[model samples]
Target chain A: MVHKALKIARVMLSVYYAYMVEYRAELVFWVLSGTFPLILMGLWVEAAQGDRFDLTPTELVQYFLAVFLVRQFTVVWVIWEFEREVVEGRLSSYLLQPVDPAWRHFFSHVSERFARLPFAFLLVGLFLLLYPYAAWLPRLDNLLLGLLATVLAFCLRFLMQYTFALAAFWIERASALEQFWFLPYTFLSGMVAPLALFPDAVRAAVLWTPFPYLIYFPASLLINRPDHVAQGFAAMVLWSALFWGLNRWLWRQGLRQYSGMGA
Target chain B: MERYLKVLRLFWGTAIAAELEYRLNFIITALISLGGLVGSLFGLFLFYRTGYQFAGWSWEEALLVLGLFTVLQGFSTTLLIPNLNKIVTQVQQGTLDFVLLKPISSQFWLSTRVISPWGLPDVLFGLVMIGYSGDRLGLTWADYGLALLPLTFGAITLYSLWFMLGATSIWFVKIYNVTEVLRGLLEAGRFPIAAYPAAYRVFFTFVVPVAFLTTVPAQTMLHQGGRGWLLASGLLAIVLALLANRFWRFALRFYTSASS
Candidate 1:
């Protein structure tokens, strides 16, 4: 049984990777669209040139670069995909499969990261090339931890969005919820500015939410700003487990609701 | 011109009626715009709370720029997004053939086909912000009037650029994300151009022309940078508008109507 499941996962990932590779041009555009962090990097780096901010210019550059990478890795579009599946009655086809429909999206997103890896790295490389001084290799343990946190971040974000997507079982425009959710994620997630720059109260409040671990925490880890590393991982795990439970319950309830509609 | 006006009325009338079915979406979008506005203020506050200003811009002046940016963003949501984003879909599905067969110009038809009223909340909030900030700055009617001239031109420039990018879908069928890139870059306009580094200022001014979108209008409003910037913005708008029309025609030449 274990061997069969592993084979299934392999085939799913390979197939999705091939499909994603076919859209190399679109992937490139997507990578470019994620350049919001780089844009903010310019402003923050400029501000850091002064004496007001907590981080120096180089540290700000590295932090935002790490943000750009974390953003690329944890980008989730499963909400949109899942909404479409539920809306167009396409979920019926997936319901016929033995494996959960969620895994298909999971594998597809995972494979897209790999397919998009080169373009993302190329952008980072170009940025570093333009400003060679901003480049710095992360310590080995920090790099490893950052990678692990990034993976966890992806899983957490995916689970959260997928749970929201399950609302499409009842609502026609469930993606609107994700849109509303994204505002807080964009502002509080430390994508716009580092938590270090945020006022003490705001940073303290934001750390309790799962937003920071999604982008800021992993990014901080990459830049060797390891503050409360254990707590950060704990919050991520706690949020993931909570979302995972809620997601499964919703899946069951949404399945019943979906079939009730004669879909 | 009369026929075009009539067609636009009909287009938007139905678009509004159809959209009204989802009345809840209005509240949702308004809440979103409100949340986004607060978040933007927070970001600006983060910069200013440290006693750092964007070079020459005072808090009120930067607020003026941000308000203009918000208005332009509303404009995009109301018109540019709903219409232009469908270009790729039309190309991919071969619906462009039908659009071409219409009695009106395809560019005009495609550009004015749909209007989403959900962006009104943003427009309202932006105007409120501008009024509040301008009041604080003790601006006269002439200042607001001068800003309007450039603001209209800025809208025209933005529409032209967006239309041209959408037109590229005739060649690359699934390139709607190219417009996403444009929107991403437009986020830079939320801050004054002077706030960025020298390279960013040049790039936003020349490469993407984001400088014309909000900064130029705000400058004209504040009576800063003289009328030279406003004149340049108008010239850029006229040229880009013409280029967008010509580019649409050029792109249409490559339309092979794959599905057809």
Candidate 2:
């Protein structure tokens, strides 16, 4: 059974990767669109040059570079995809398929990430070349941990957004809800700034929430701050399980509701 | 001119009434707009907490720039983006033929066919922010008066840029990603252009010209940009409008009817 599932996953990944390559322009745009972190990096680096923040300019650069890298991995678009399918009645086709619809979304997103990886690497390489001052030597252990944390972070974000997308079952405005969720996520996820730069009260409050575990904790690992690694992993696992439960509940309810509506 | 006004009134009246049918969307959009405003302000607050001026602009000045950015963003969302999106879809679905068949200029009709009244809350919120920031700066009435000229030109420039992008759908049916690219670039306008590095400053000013969208207007209001800059902005708007119009015509020539 496990072997069959692995074979299916392999075929799905290859198919989606081939399909994703057709939109090379869009793939490039997606990579460029994720450069907001670099913009914030520029601002913080300039400020740090004035010795205002406790962070040195080089530290600010490394932190935001890590942020840019982590952001590329943690991106999610399943909310939009699910919303479109549900609204347009395309979900019916997926419902009839033998495989779960969510797996298709997962495979497609993973493949797109693979397609986007080279562009992201090229951009990062160019950025580092242009700003060599931003270079840093991360410890090998921390680097490995950062990669692990990043994988977990990506899974957490994707599942969370997929759960949010399930709201489409009840409302036509699920995307709006997604936007509402996005606002807080932007601040809490350390996309705007390192959570450490936030006031102590805000940082403490955010750490308790699952948002920081999605981006900040992983990013902090790369910067050699592993003090919270164990706790971060614990929060990640707890939140993932909770979201997984919520997703199953919502999917069952939504499917019933959808079929009742004659879809 | 009177005929265009009548047509616009009729178009907006029906469009708004059609949108009102989705009552829940109104509340959702209002909340989303509010969320966006709060998110931008929170970002500014974080920078302010650092207690250092960004690009020589204090927190108050930076807030004004953000307000102007929000106002222009609200305008684009309210009047421009939805219409452009509709045109792109029409082009894709071969429904643009009906638009071209209309007696009115297709450009004008396509540009004015939709107005999202639900976006008004963002405009109101942005105006309130601008007023508050202006009060803090103690701007004279004349400063506000001068700011209006550049703001009008900026709106024209942005509209032309969007129209040009929409027109390109004639050739590239899936130009939605280009629109997304523009949206991403516009995010930079939330801060003063000076806050960016020299390379980015040049790119945003001359290449994309997002600086005119917000930064110049805010600077003009604060008595920062001299009249020379204002004149240059006006010239750029006219030049861009003409260039966009020409590009639209050029694309139209290549547009073999999607239906056929």
Instruction: List, for all models, the DockQ compared with the true complex.
Output: 0.84, 0.65
TM-score of each: 0.99, 0.96
Q: lDDT for every model?
A: 0.93, 0.86
Looking at model 2 chain A, which ten-residue stretch has the lowest summed lDDT? A254-263
Assess candidate 2 and give its TM-score to the true structure: 0.96
Point to the candidate with the largest lDDT: 1
lDDT of 2 by residue, A173-263 (tens): 6877678888888878888888878889988888888988888888889988675788899999999999999999999989988842335
Worst 10 residues of 1 chain A by lDDT: A254-263
Instruction: Tell me how far the alpha carbon of residue B260 in candidate 1 is from the true structure, in angstroms, after superposition.
Output: 2.3
The C-alpha RMSD in Å for every predicted model, in order, reads 1.1, 1.7
In candidate 2, which residue pairs clash?
A: none
Kindly report which residue stretches of model 1 are placed more than 4 angstroms away from their true locations once superposed: A260-263
